[model samples]
Target: MKPHQQGTERVITSLDWLAVLPVGLLLRQVDLTGCGPTCITVSRWRPGAGAGGLEGTGLCVCKEDGAVCGSDGRSYRSVCALHLRSWVSLQSGGERIRKAHDGECKLAPVIVVSPKKIHNVTGAQVYLSCEVKAVPTPVITWRKVSESPKGVKLLEELPGDRVNMAVQVRGGPSKHEGTGWVLINPLMKEDEGVYQCHATNMAGEAHADGSITVTEQNKSKKASLLAWDNPS
Candidate 1:
């Protein structure tokens, strides 16, 4: 097809040739034939229409378009790319594809903000928090890391009738994100250990760890006194 310059856009006059160019190259061609400024349109050729007739033509090119998500949970470089794929699929007798949303598709959980190490004295309250981002929203759970008698590591889900500890989770300090927190009131020596933030979704799972260190009230004061005396 021969494309002639029409102001800032390109217009294809001949429909005798079909080209399936790479997405990068097509995008770089600023003068790609298009129907409008925002989107690329594609049309199927009519069998009986002469090359001079623009009958049954529908598709255009959008060089500046952003990526789009497909209904099949995949990402396309642009709307034109998705339409091209859909056309190819239809020609192959496969399912027709449609646009799901703007932007790339996400399918896995990611730990955005991990909990940090904490040190506290006995009888003090402490909070550990974690944030995760994922598509379809992820479920956040808190777990305490423990060692078994056989030296294997174990993860115990938190807030199971533990009077001193509580866990809470909620969605979004941002889109597609969830935050979780574990509160330990009147912290004790037994509550000192590694805590895990576990996030799971239909696509996948993610994990992060935080720790708590507790000191008896008397021991904490004594240590402070020792540090003061040493001046180090």
Candidate 2:
């Protein structure tokens, strides 16, 4: 603030957009219309993010055109928090929505596997899993590095089965939306090849891979009668 400027101290708050919607909008009617130093509104990064952590975006109340109100988008009573929560509604005049459109915080579903280090035999069945850290449970699919595992003898598959989604994938619970399972059933010798886990959601697909080794069993016990015979 310049020496000449007075009453321009902005109000800061801890509430997120969702928590401050109903009353925060009212800040515009009184705060902006007042005849004091233009209220310079600002806030601490997401409450839970802690003292120094800042994950969400913010708004700046600039005194342009000799007034808190200006033609350049900044001239709003309220700014919808980065993602347009609520209190942000009145202070920034919906800046959050505009930002969301221009700069989305979408999380591309990423495939993460547990026990990333796995070893299997030709006749052993293997199990791999993945989850998208993004919102909206993504579609989970399986693939082979070499080729699709189609046309396999399902009945004779090692572990005697195929890896497939156990349940219809939908938006996982809010906290674990992009989560899913990848099951490899009746793993076989040819199936020893590497397998890829794919999870796709509206945002995008995330990828991860796991290597598989199929150790062949030793030859059967049958031996030829003439084997090791002394040559005349």
Using TM-score as the measure, the top candidate is 1
* Model 1 agreement with the true structure over 154-228: per-residue lDDT tens digits: 999998889999999999999889999999998999999999999999889999999999999999899899999
Show pairs that collide, candidate 1: 41-59, 41-60, 42-58, 42-59, 42-60, 43-58, 43-59
Quickly count the clashes in candidate 1. Answer: 7
In candidate 1 the C-alpha lDDT for residue 85 amounts to: 65
For each candidate, the alpha-carbon lDDT, in order, equals 0.77, 0.44
TM-score of each: 0.60, 0.42
- Tens digits of per-residue lDDT, candidate 2, 45-115, equal 44445667543223333332221222223322233332223334557764323322222244567655432
Best by lDDT: 1
